[model samples]
Target chain A: MRNVFGKIINTKMLYEYVSLQRLLFLLSLCLSCLYALAGFTIVATLNYIGEDIYGYLFLIFGICFLLTGISSIKINKKKSVRILIFSLILFLIVFVSTAYPSSVGLQDYGLSASLTYNMIFSIGLIIFGLIGALLSLGALFNFKPLGNQYGAYFLLVVCMLIILYPLVIIIGQVTINGAPGITWEFLTSDVRGLGESGGILPAIVGTLLLMFIMFVIAVPLGIGAAIYLEEYAGGHFMVRVIKMAVSILRGVPSIVFGLFALAFFVPIFGISFLTGGLVLSFYALPMIIRSSAEALKSIPQGLREGSLALGATKWQTIRRVVLPPSLPGIITGVVLGIGEAAGETAPLLFVSTLIIKMPPNLLGMVASLPTHLYTLFGMRGGLGDEVEVAARMQNAWSTALILLTIILILNVVALVIREKFRKEF
Target chain B: MKKKLSKEHIIQGIFLLIASFSIFIIFFIFFFLFKEAIPAFIEVGGDIFSTDFSNELGLGGAIRGSLIVTGGALLIAYPLGIGGGIFLSEVASVWIRRILKPIIEVLAGIPSVVYGFIGAIILVPFLTDSFRMISGFSLLAGGLIIGVMTLPIIISISDDSLKSVPREIKEASLALGATPWQTIKKVTFPAASSGIFAGATLGVGKALGETMAVLMVVSAITRAPDSWFDIFESGPVLTSLIAGHWGEAYGLKVNVLFAAGVFLFIIVSVMSIISEIMQYRIEKKFKGG
Candidate 1:
């Protein structure tokens, strides 16, 4: 029994257990997998080409199923296993029958029936694939050990794939569409007619300017706070309260930060670059403080003690012994904070000038990459002409690509610093 | 020597002031949100909690929408995240971990606006087509986008928690003739349950605070879903309400949006605090306290 179901099942045994019921189960599984593949192709393309590919795939699956079915009919398998596969196939087929066509208008060739039919069919196929694979694994092998182990592995792999799927799509989409819009002129010129004809020079410049101001403001205060909390505070009550507040602060929505900036900083700084920068700094502070504190905490206690033992004052110890070793960690935090601030749009929505034709000054409003994308997204339908709309979309994609590239670079740098440069205590 | 001692005192004072700046910022955020939000609470009275979007800026629908979308997001994220965590912490080898960890970080770093852009362009139309919804901007789309956005947190935190389970416990389970799968299911999972729960709470907090993606994908209509399970319907969440209405809102409307902001702040803060406490407890537990 274990030999049949185990990882090393011989072809002789594999064919030996192929009862009529087992053949039916194998055929159903193969058909459902094909349905799923067809569904995936159809949904992905939503084109006639997808249908053509589906036909070819179906033919291939059909031949494979036929071959397997012909070669594998020898002995009866467990009735219970046969019953489970039969019911599972029945359930899937039942779902396929009831899967109604989507009511959404399919003006092109009345493709609604095929579209929705394949979609739900593929969904049923996926469910059946999961159940059938498990049942087949158990029926073929000892159910107790290998089936459960591999089944759990299968589910985890699916979860990882699902998580990675969007990332792959987003990057691929942005690069394919946005790459065309990244010409030299597009990089240098100002946006014209809702990002149709012009470039994003001002937005790029403003993003950098905002990052600079944020770096100037957030780093010292964040590092200082981190230093105080990690090296100096000891067991103070205020330290604990401050830490709690920081955690809570980290979770505060960016939109609320926008609201706060609108109410507090805008009145004081008046929608200028400084206000946007300060709001971003406020958005970034918790992260920096937390990360910097983590860095400071990781430095060996002996190093600090060694400095203090040598009669180096507390401040002197931190400035020399403690700071140098943890610099990589602190710098990584700053890079991440900058990356975060660069992509922020909500906090800047109410505060940023958003559509500045020229590069921003420190005292004036800013045009950032994120807000640029937001503005372009918002204006897609409002623009009068199709050309204008399409152009705006092109620019939006380009902006997203640029923004993603910048953030990804920063992330990689941080990753490098942590992996290569960080001092291991 | 005396001058050096006084210099140290001065530096300490300076650092103290800098550290307290965080506390001050937190205070001002609360103060400013209150200052702006209180007017709506007073004028709208108990109607501030009304679920009807059309009823003079009631927040009931938005709150309910927030719950539905966030709940939906949690539904998708929780299982996948824990499973991914298990894969990372237990199943993957050290070399694989080294590669996968950074990739997950990159996933987390992808800006919310980018997620929104993709969702608005791809997922929304797909959902609209598949489900035959009004426009495709529904609780489901918002939930899906936010679910992806929140996956990294849940994955990393759960991975951390699962890894934190003392190896001895798992080893003992193995010694008792339990299979590896059984060890994970029975021993490691039970021990890491609190930490996993904390990761979930943190993920929920993040999903709750998500703005741009939810705003872009969730059709921000000011009405509760017709039924509790009606995720296909478009409804406003608090973050979306504040963001979507900010452009045209005036007078009492502005205060109402601020009130929505206050509501978001309080709820997310509560989630963060709870998760933090639970994590602290887990740390204490593992430390033999």
Candidate 2:
């Protein structure tokens, strides 16, 4: 294999083996890069031209660049290193040309129809060109077989970045906006004046209380159902029905749960802590069941069999052998369910009420964190002067931050428990 | 021993009851939603599909808006999600995958309300400013936010599917002189396509059923878009319609909202069932093969 590879590289005739198709491929790549360059710089330089034509030109350029860059994959195969280098240079030109309008210089142009069009066009050009450049560079360095692999990895990296961008921005914005509002006073006093003044102590306490109630109501049922499915039940009709019902329940929108509560729980229990907790428990049940079932599944069957073989009954084996190892996973599930319930607003919309002055009793209306944030946002413009409205907005942000913090803490705890107690058979 | 055996039977019976509670809850939810919604279905009849929101309560526009927003969301989610999945399963180092998996989990754990709040505060004004629209609340904003919300589902499930492809098959392809990308494209992706499709279907269900954020970012105007591509205009979706109007809803309006909930429930249930069947089939295929 090495001798054949060496012979092919040593051949003089192979270096001159460029066909018309290859030449056209090279020409098209060059022209496409030029088109993107002209679209980015020349189009921006001629800003007074009708913006419509610029958009059309960009649309044309974007397509041209994408098509040419994509087409080069097939055309460049087994090509000489010289051609690969040329293609790399062309891609570099396209990248540098397009990077200007889409990057740091983006703000200078301000927001305009043509500017937005130009920005979108340039960004597309940058992405395609950069991918092309990476592929060609890989080929240029004698990684011919792995060139496309490198390009694929580049795309995956881009996808990861796209997924992470919003999370970073959401957390950054919430913390920056909500940090000042989270003084000691904010955590320990009653929210007054339609949330224009005072703090969210009642809301915080109510959220904890609601989480507790939800935990108490949901955990046993979820774990019991999971145990029944995992240990007790056989492949029967009831099991299938239960599984299907759980999936259906999981897909039911939170607002639908709210409507269900309004129609059923509210009429029976009225709008109180009981109603809210019941709805949230229903909301949390599917998640808890699913996760707990997963946890139970992870316990090796041999352990259960070993216990049963030693004369332990099924329940005894589960209580002593199965439950201990799976406890962390079950706890993780319960914590996640409670975390989800804590951040839920839709299920509590009609089932809970805002109580600013005091902590809510079990059978009375209560404030939950998510609903408090919602109420504050709803009252954004109706309350008073700008300052008061701003104050309300601040409280809304703080409430959001607190809600986010609790959920994040719960999630971290869940992750830690899962990792810490993960058992390998 | 007899007493202990009977106690075991009693405990099993208790568990059976607990397991069956889900079915009971599902039945009750359906019964009550139908009880409230049937009145509107009978009274308004076919007019429940009306697009106009001025005088009568109708769901046609909301349904259309829901479809449009979900379509937009799917466009954004399908590529990024599957790509991220491919990366996690096929490309990333172990430590990178470990770090990224939790980040995606945290992304999933972020509340819908926070996503909506961020959309309303940041994305709305940005869209309004860039597009020079009358208001920033549009279906596009709703789609963008919901797309992010559904990514964790699609990514994680697709990753699982891709990872489940047998290592021996991938090695055989690599041994055959196929590039890694070729192996992924021709072997791995085809094998995992059904699972990815399942993920996409579940993502559709999620995007369709998303509320709060859509309610916050999308216009409350209970009218259909002026045209097929008119996402710049504010339009209400079904979830948003039920949530936005339930505040002052009275008499028939309340029932109409319930009717909307019924449709949302039905559509999302169908999506879930289809995805569930697909997932079950995939699992069977893998285990059997």
- Taking all chains together, each candidate's TM-score versus the true structure is 0.89, 0.86
Highest TM-score: give the candidate number: 1
Second chain alone, TM-score for each candidate? 0.96, 0.96
User: For residues A129-176, what per-residue lDDT tens digits would candidate 2 score against the true structure?
Assistant: 454445344443334556567656766786787788788888999999
lDDT of 2 by residue, B1-289 (tens): 9999999999999999999999999899989999999999999898989887547778888998999899999899889899999989988899998889888988988888888888898888776655556677898889888998989888998998899889999999999989888899999999988888986787888889888889889957776776656777788899988888887889999899999999998998898888888887888898899
Which ten contiguous residues of candidate 2 chain B have the minimum total lDDT?
B125-134
Off by over 4 Å in 2: A1-115, A125-144, A423-425
Clashing pairs in 2: none
What TM-score does chain A reach in every model?
Answer: 0.81, 0.76
DockQ of candidate 1, scored on C-alphas against the true complex (2 decimals): 0.55
Cα error, candidate 2, residue A181 (Å): 1.5
Clashes of each: 5, 0
Pairs that collide, model 1: A5-A140, A5-A141, B50-B60, B51-B60, B51-B61
